[model samples]
Target chain A: QQQVKQSPQSLIVQKGGISIINCAYENTAFDYFPWYQQFPGKGPALLIAIRPDVSEKKEGRFTISFNKSAKQFSLHIMDSQPGDSATYFCAAVDTGFQKLVFGTGTRLLVSP
Target chain B: DTAVSQTPKYLVTQMGNDKSIKCEQNLGHDTMYWYKQDSKKFLKIMFSYNNKELIINETVPNRFSPKSPDKAHLNLHINSLELGDSAVYFCASSLRGESEAFFGQGTRLTVV
Candidate 1:
């Protein structure tokens, strides 16, 4: 069974528009949620991360809004640009154990 | 310098053959992980090592084995390659168990 589920298998946004991707987890034990961005022929890179204790975390133009009670989290990109086109993955991990469960990826396309 | 490095960016091998993928991390992290991304772009954790000791092993087949000679190096060896094994493998390292991870450029393996 998939521990984490992500929505919108693909997304397209215009430059200066907002881009959003959502994810939900079934396991309540998950405490750490992280987002990864991957380009073609490259490895995934850490974008942003949030802990369950925080309702939201923002860095630069990337923000992660987390709802601990709803077991859901979403990534928001402000002023999306063409360079933001890539695959995004949401992952959950239990601090008690080191295993990380990843959600199905979301491919984002930003057109100028 | 690359924080995490994996050798043999692309490998094409026939069925019943054996191959190895080497991974090394220079981030001074104690935890390392091996992740596989399938054709559908789903990423799954296969193995994890902490301080050169095996910590997590997913339900991967016995044909796949991971060896960690040291905290900085983790290698994967496959025996009897199969078409189903064709995918991109990534190596990652983290300072803490459930923290942000640094990933290496993936190694694409195509089993014929």
Candidate 2:
């Protein structure tokens, strides 16, 4: 199917806390998974990405946890800050068509 | 430099009018795409072009047309816009066979 399901349509976290967003896919053909961060009036920017070969990928304060067996993945933001408040989207891409199937989106808020 | 950019960030037009949105990517990617996000925040791929050639076209009304003169540029044209056409459209690009795709800020189209 062409769906990447995401959870917690909205989330609120205090500064210095941890924020997590989860996503799952039904298609096993997906090879690339990426997370995107978007601020109001801006396009979604690539935060971090991981392939099925690796279990996880970390970039600065953001980390992506991937599970090939469960067909699920998650994004973790360490030391949440107000500036980190934004909408996060998780997407999966199949190798054959290279078409991206995006999740419903999660609005994350980090309060200071 | 902006990897991807779209013109007229906000477009408010009346029904039955025709309008166009232009997109350009400085990333020198060989593939460009158009996606639409509705009120529910579901992002759906509408069109994709590689080397200025149309590769994929999802189910959409005939009123909508996509043109790409080259790999760096892709534009969308709409004729006889309807109320249901109101949505935020995003242009994105990536090098062929790559995972991450750069996205434009998005054009918010409101048809009244």
Docking class for model 2 is: high
Number of backbone-clashing residue pairs for each candidate, in the order shown = 0, 0
List the candidate 1 regions with Cα displacement exceeding 4 Å. none
lDDT per residue (tens digit) for residues B1-112 in model 1: 9899999999999999999999999989999999999999999999999999988999999999999999999999999999999999999998865478889999999998
- Candidate 1 lDDT over A24-94, as tens digits, reads 99888888999999999999999999999999999999999999888999999999999999999999987
Model 2: share of real contacts kept: 0.79
- lDDT of candidate 2 over B11-39, digit per residue (tens): 99999999999999999799999999998
lDDT against true structure, model 2: 0.93
Tens digits of lDDT, candidate 2, A1-112 = 8789999899999999999999999999899999999898888898899999999899999999999999999999999999999999999987567688899999999988
